[model samples]
Target: MTLLLPPTSEVPVPKFNMADLTARLLAPGKPQEAQQQSSPALNPPDAPEAHEEVRERRRAYQRPAGHPSRQERAQARALAQQYRDYAEAWYQALRAWDMREVKIPYSFHYEPGESDLDFLTLGSNVRTPTRYLQTPAGEFTEGEVGVVITTMSRAPLVEQMQLGKMLDKLRHTPDTTPVSLLREDGRWHQNRERVARYAVAVLTLAVQLRDEGAEGPLRYAKAVLAGAH
Candidate 1:
């Protein structure tokens, strides 16, 4: 028996020219052209204009001749006012705490006489002077002295000014200053317990301010108390 085969339709064959392929492969521009066609351009038609708009916006936001813009000025004023509020709050807290100075005897070895020649001839001797502090808690320990002195010394300028004002208001003598105390060679150290107590007191004040709807004072109190640790 003979088997019959099905008739097939004509199919077009794709023909590749070796010379054209070789030319395309050799031509550097061909790959770039094909890439340009295959992938979209890095920048669209409106890219230049968009970039210009962004640049213009940046320029608009930039300060002129180191002078801040109105918005920036407003922001700075707000920040300064905020710090002022913090200073005021700290002052009030200190006042409320009623820190009283107590006189204590401080003995130190010092070179007697003003001149170095006198020091060389006379030698150093122990001198006892009356010292004063709000508390005598950490008067002998180096660690506490370092921590308290360092913390107080590193206080922000605004806070330092407030402290100076507080000192003056409280009629505290120069010898009662933290630096002076620190220079006394273990005469005094800031009390960590006192600091922690003050922090808690400030936190309580912050809560009270919040309850009283005093947002500014509350925020200031919170900010001031943040350095307690």
Candidate 2:
């Protein structure tokens, strides 16, 4: 029986030129482009250092200092704590009632520290949910009244001056014009008035506790307004 056998001789392949192969592979269609050869003698070593300096300057410009002063940061933290306390008080007051009675949908807070105020606002136009037992007849409302706190300096001169200007406006016109006297004049005067009212309430409560022997009544009122705790 005869069997088919394969040839023993190897087929010779053509050796290609390195430059022609490189031109075919790397520099396909482009004509004789100059190769990017590096020269350490001609280039300055400080080029990288100059580039790094430019990059660092750009980063410095992009990012700024977080807090200018430690004292200012501490004051901000204290103010934030006060705001939390104020919010807790307001929330306690609101949650005292059944959800059916006061369905507070949207409440907003603004820190007007520069304007010497912080505000707790209720959007509803009805009577304020807060009931003042001392409120005269026909003065009760379920809509708007919340509280504002004046974070102004605790100096009598500054307080009196600011309050005096506000009082003069209140006494003279008896109109709620939403304007401020500050150079910045940031917030509406109505908000400032609310904060002033809270300050008055604080003073009134203090005075009553001191002389009128009304500590029990004040406690009861606060309990009623701010729920259990």
Candidate 3:
């Protein structure tokens, strides 16, 4: 039986190739490529596209320091209540929005020579509807000396400034334009940013009114962000 004995001497260690080891460690691989691909490029703030974005452009209103005065707070509360009223009115107006459709009535003088049943070709341009009022005897009040004429140009349908137009204008309106002047009639004055805020208030309130129970919360959009188009 042959027995193998360990040599009483130091074993020679193989030298490592540092360059090769480094090449392997720093080598470009699928993971590197994947990471590079996943990384997003930073956008320049001064880019032309960035400038095109319409933001919540508003004016700075001066206010007293730290805590607002009681009178100011009361005024703020009043403004809030006023906005709520405007929102309800705007919602109702939107619900009833429709193109103007007016009608008019005309009277004809019966001639003895003409048959009772005759072709009545009535075609005229009128924007309001008109109906004749007759007495119990099925006749218009006799002895009517004057013609009570009434004319409507559909202007009554929109007695307020165009809200839809304002909505659009606010998106691209200049800083000087006042949109904060939201009136009880669902119209607004200049101030584009404030107007945008008002619109947001209305929409937010409207969504609430519908009781959709939308999780999270719907935010009001800025007028400047709401493009004129």
Candidate 4:
């Protein structure tokens, strides 16, 4: 049997660095420029020398070395959950849905001598080679192909809120987004792709189990993904 995923014991907790974010947030706020100007003894905030000194001071900021803070950990958890939801939505309406066989809702028959009305009378069956394709078991029966899932349909309300916020931000500025902004806003960066793939694997298993297509294939996928046989 082909394995779908590595064993759970083999899967370690995924790590991503949010240290830059923690540093910025925990850093001191901007100086009160308007108030600072009132003091004649203080150097002009915009002066190159003062700017250089401030920049050097800011660069010295360092976060404690160890596990992330409670806030940072929560941020990571929320980010992961959001990514999983996005992955689920992505696969639901993918090409597999397009390949499902179409079923006519109403039946119709040709009148009296309709032999001449057949869609095609002189057509020959085509024998195309399918050597490279893997055949899936069972024939497709038309049923729920075009389902319009409404609000809060695929996931919980909170998850929908998360997904909504995420998509909105993506619509505005997808490019030129930096890593720190991603961590602060809980958006996914190019980090830890295995978790997204793991989400896909789990969703595929769920689909197979739901359709009950074939127990043999489902068991193999489940065993590999869930570390159970």
Candidate 5:
């Protein structure tokens, strides 16, 4: 019998260039004004030049070579934690036992916004095809706010229609929507096995979240948990 192997280890992530944000916020024009203020004695002299020097200095301070300050580090930690939470939540939904027989070869990520749904592919067992879902100047499904799951491959017409209907119901209903994905042919079907698996995955995630909340993170941990809830 052949033994199954674990998934390959993900690559190392690069540190975020926090300086990019700081630079944008501290752009040149404003710095020049501040620099002119520094030397009131110089007659309407080169305020722009002064601003340039000030901006340069500000840039240097914003991104020092040494380790980040405590506050900076804390912000980084918070962002890191959010990434972790998102991953955990998705994984919980994906690994439900009910969906075991169904192929879930593709991995997907979504960010819900006021007007559009942004999709990100997280490298699935299926072919890598990334796409974005947009209203596209009012073709259809515009102004109607809810989640829409699109597959790289087409699903059965009936199952596709059912998915749309169920999604509408869930949107109107107070509870979070439950959707199931079949790996083979990348279909979105409402089969009992698929639904059960999806439900179990989400429920497990919610339970895990509650458990994490219960375990205190000291003062900082408490603050993080509070923010999450």
Candidate 6:
């Protein structure tokens, strides 16, 4: 026997459009606006421009290369003045130590016409004066002497002779005066190591003098020598 079925209008039919689904799948994807809103911007509107940033860096680099400021110049002048004052103090201390300035006749063999002759003769005997600070301990000379030759009274004979030979090897003009050992030219002398040794010798003498009841100038000299570097 056949069974009775319900009316087609009463049963709702579901619709499936293949063409619309295919079109939607094949269409290009729209920009992900939500993802863009979540991430940070590469160049924010409030940030400085690239050229402006470059200019700022350039200015910072050039600041050091420009002329010194007023404060810097003032500081440099003050430092130079201090050095001069210290040098004068050191000289005064040496004077107080009974240091007598003496000139020794230094003769050397030079070419006949290399310098003006002391005597009108065709000989290689050239006399250049050597200056020394004759102290009770030893003889002291400047760093320009090119050798650290402090001939102490108690030094060995062999050492004294060697120092004499070294002194003889130095060449100088006949009119050259003794250079001060403590004169600072904003830098160390040519022979920095030798100059330092000379300073040490001076400091040692100053220390000895201080021990012998001479405390005032020697103390200042010691301070200057200690900070000479």
Clashes of each: 0, 6, 9, 0, 2, 0
Candidate ranking (lDDT, best to worst): 6, 1, 5, 4, 3, 2
Best by lDDT: 6
lDDT of each: 0.39, 0.34, 0.35, 0.37, 0.38, 0.41
In model 5, the runs with Cα more than 4 Å from the true position are 1-70, 97-150, 153-229
Model 3 per-residue lDDT at 141:
19
Tens digit of lDDT per residue, candidate 4, span 100-121?
Answer: 3333333345576766666643
Give the TM-scores of the predictions, in the order they appear. 0.23, 0.19, 0.23, 0.21, 0.21, 0.23
Error of 3 at 48 (Å): 68
State how far residue 217 of model 1 sits from its true place (Å).
13
Question: In model 6, where do residues sit more than 4 Å from their true spots?
Answer: 1-152, 155-178, 182-184, 211-229
For model 3, what is the alpha-carbon lDDT of residue 66? 39
Question: What is the C-alpha lDDT profile of model 3 across 118-170, one tens digit per residue?
Answer: 55424323344533322211222112201211111112434112433333343
Candidate 3 lands at a TM-score of 0.23
lDDT tens per residue, model 5, 1-229: 9985433222112233555434534666676654433333332224568545545444544464465767889987776454334333343333321121223356665655634433354354475433321221111221222223322012367545454454344334425544323323333233534343333333222333343431322233224334443
Q: List the residue pairs that clash in candidate 1.
A: none
Q: Quote the lDDT for 161 in model 1.
A: 41
Could you give me the TM-score of model 5 versus the true structure?
0.21
Model 6 CA lDDT for position 73: 95
The sequence of per-residue lDDT tens digits that candidate 1 reaches over residues 32-128 is 6533322222322345665454444334333233456778889967774554444334434334333334444434454666555544434234343
lDDT of 6 by residue, 35-123 (tens): 22222222222334643543443333233333475788998677644544443333334433233455454554556656575554543
lDDT, residue 148, model 3? 14
TM-score quality measure for candidate 4: 0.21
Better lDDT candidate (2, 5): 5
Model 2 Cα lDDT, one tens digit per residue, 66-181: 42355777886665444333322322222232122433345555755646433345353334344331121112223222211122222256643453344333323434522222
Ten-residue region with minimum lDDT total, candidate 4: 143-152
